[model samples]
Target: MRVTTTHQLYTARLPNGGAAVMDVRSGRGQWQHLNSTAALLWNQVIEGADLSKAANRLTATLAAQGAEEAVVRADLAALVSHLRALGLLAASPAPAPDPAPMHVREVLPAHTRLSLPDRAAGLLALATALFLLRCTPIRAAIAAARLVARLPLRPAAPERADQLFAAVRRVRSAWPGRAACLEESLACSFAAALRGRAVTWVIGARTAPAGAHAWNETHGNQVIGQDPEDRIWPYAPALRVRHGRNK
Candidate 1:
C-alpha cells in the first residue's frame, strides 16, 4: 500500500485580531475570526483532539442555544472545509501521521547595512510635519519649526527652496538603491508621526514627465514642487497641502 504524508501548514495573525492559516505548498488560505466559539474550537483542535469528537462537542454546546442539528452539522462541515483548504487537515491514502514542527527565518540578511542617521532625521521631519498639519486651530508654522528643532541632529540650514529640493533628492536617490524596504521604512516613519492626528497619510506612485516619482499633498491643495502633480502620494496629505505649490 502506498502512503502519503500530509504537509504542515502555517498561520499568521492579522492586525484585526483574526487568524489566517495557509498551506505553504498548495497556496490555499483560510481565515477565522477570534470569537468565543472559534476560540473554543481552536483550543480543542490544537490539543490533539479528534475532529469528529470536536464537532460533536461544538454541536452539543450550540444545541443548548436552540441551534438545530442540521445547522450544527453545517457549521462543522464549513469549519472542516476551511481547515482543509488552508492545508491544516488532509486525509492521506492511509491514516494521518503526526505533522512535523515548523520554523521561521528572517527575510533580510543580518549583514544588511543601513544609514541610521539619515533615516532618523527623515523620520523626525516627517513627525514634525504631521503634528503641525493635523492639530486643531492650525498652530503657526513656528510650531512645525520648533518640532524640527528638537531633533537630535539637524540637516544643514538652507534656503527654503534648497531644503525642499534636498528632501526630494534624498528620497529619489534612496528609492533605486534600497528598493521596497527603503520605501516601506520611510512610509512607516511617516505614518507613525501622523497617528492620532486628523491628517491622512497616503503613499502612492506614478510615472511623471521626468520619471516615476512620489510626492505628498496637504489640505491646502498646494503641490510642493514644480512637479508636485507627478502622480504620487506623499507621507502626509495635510502637511503636503500646506507645503505644496504649483510650479
Candidate 2:
C-alpha cells in the first residue's frame, strides 16, 4: 500500500516537539496524537515516501539510537498498519492538496443585519449545517454549500457578508448544543454561500496551546466573527476552503 494521506486530514506541529493529526472526514472530527517515533514515520509518508523508502529512513534513524534494523522495521510496519486501518493512509499514491496559505487582516465590524429574506436564508443555512454536521463529513457538508452557492447570483456586498455572519451567530444562539468555533464558522460560511456570497472557511492551529480552531473571512481579507478578546489571532490557519479572491 502507498503511504498517501486523504484530503480530509489536518496536521500540525506542536510547540513542544510533537505532532497533531485530525481526521475531519467524519463531521465529529476524530484526533490521533503521534509520538516522536510515529511522527517520523508520518512525516515520511506525508512527504510522499513509499513503504520501503519510509522503512529505510526509519531504520536508519532508529539505528542511531542503537536499535536493531529488524526490530525497527517490524515496528514501522505495525504502525503503518494501524494508521491505514484508521483511514489516514491511502491505498494509492493519490496526492492530497496542500493547506491554504494564511493571510488575514483586521476583523470585520459586527454592525450589520439582514433583511427578511436574507434572514430566512441564513436561518435555513444554519439549520442545514447543524443537521449535516451530525450525519455527513465536513468535506461533504462544505461541498453541499458550494453546490447551493453555484447559482448565478451576484457576489455579496461587504455589508451583506457581515449581516450573514451575524445572522448565523444569532441562529446558533438558540441551539441547545454548545457550538464551537468549527460549527459556528462553517455555518456562517454556508449561510454566506447561500446568499451567493463567497467566503473562506479557515481551520487554524495554535502551537502554544496545542489546539485548533475554525473561522470565516471575506474576500477583502477581513476575518469574520473575530473578537479582540478571543483566541483567533493566536491560531495560524492550517487549512482554508477558499471560494473567491480571499487570500
Candidate 3:
C-alpha cells in the first residue's frame, strides 16, 4: 500500500498586511489567505496530523468555550472544501509526505547570447517593439510580448544577422543623416529582432569618457556580459538589466 504524508506549506507577507499561504505540492500557482485560526489549524496539519484531526482540534477548543460543535463542524467542512479547491489539500490512501524544497538555480536556465541581426538597425527595431508591447495593459498580451522579446535572435535560422548589422552600422555611421529616417530604421530593426522573444536593449552612456554603448538582455532581467548594476545612464530609463558583455 502507498503511504501518503501531509505536504508542508509556506507563508509569505502580501503587499497588504494579510498573509498568503502557498501549497508547496501545488507549486506557486496555489495560494490561499490564512486567518489566525486557519493558520493554527494549518500548522497542526503540517505536523503529521490529518485534516479531520485538525478540524476536531479546532471544534474541541471552540466547544470548551460553550460554542456550538455543530456550527464549528460545518465551518471546518466548508473551509476544507475551499482549501481542496485551491489545491492546498489532497486525499490519498496513506499519509501524504512533504515534498523537497526546490532551489532557484534549479529552475532558472543558464545564460547565453541570443542570435540577433549583426546590423544595429535590426536590434534597435526589436527593442522598440518590445517597449511598445510592454506598454499594453492587458496581462496576456503583455506576457506574450515579453516571451517573444526574451527569445534570442538566431541568425542561423531564417534571419540574416550580418545583413541587419551592416544596415544598422551604416545608419549609425552617417552622423549627418535625417534624424527621422534614422529613428524609423532603428525602430524597425529592433521590432523585427524582438518579434517573439523577451529581451531588452540598453542604449546609453557607460562612463564620463567612454561615450555610449548599446546592448541587449533577456527577460529584462539578465544581461549578457556587463555588470548591469554598475552601468550608469544619462538618457532614457535604465532598461531592466545592467550593461554587460554578451555571454
Model 2 per-residue lDDT tens digits across residues 149-206 = 4444455555666677778777777788877777777887777767767766766565
Whichever of 2 and 3 has more TM-score, that candidate is: 2
Residue-by-residue lDDT tens digits, candidate 3, 1-247:
2222232344432222233453434321234565555656665665557778788988999889898999978877887888788666653211212211211111112232334533443446534533443444222222333344344553221123223333443434454533332133234335445443223433322223333333333331222223235444321211221112111
Query: Which candidate wins on lDDT?
Result: 2
The candidate, 1 or 2, that scores higher on lDDT is 2
Lowest summed lDDT across 10 adjacent residues in model 3 is found at 99-108
Off by over 4 Å in 2: 1-8, 12-19, 25-27, 35-37, 58-87, 90-114, 137-139, 146-160, 220-222, 236-239, 244-247
TM-score of every prediction relative to native: 0.32, 0.68, 0.31
> Which candidate's TM-score is highest?
2
Q: Which residue pairs overlap in candidate 1's backbone?
A: 216-234, 217-237, 217-241, 218-237, 218-240, 218-241, 222-244, 223-244, 223-245, 224-244
Worst 10 residues of 1 by lDDT: 238-247
Clashing pairs in 2: none
Worst 10 residues of 2 by lDDT: 91-100
Q: For model 1, how does the per-residue alpha-carbon lDDT over 106-185 read when each residue is reduced to its tens digit? A: 12222333345444544554444434433422222222322322333322221222233234234444544332321332
Candidate 3 ranges with C-alpha deviation above 4 Å:
1-8, 12-19, 24-30, 91-247
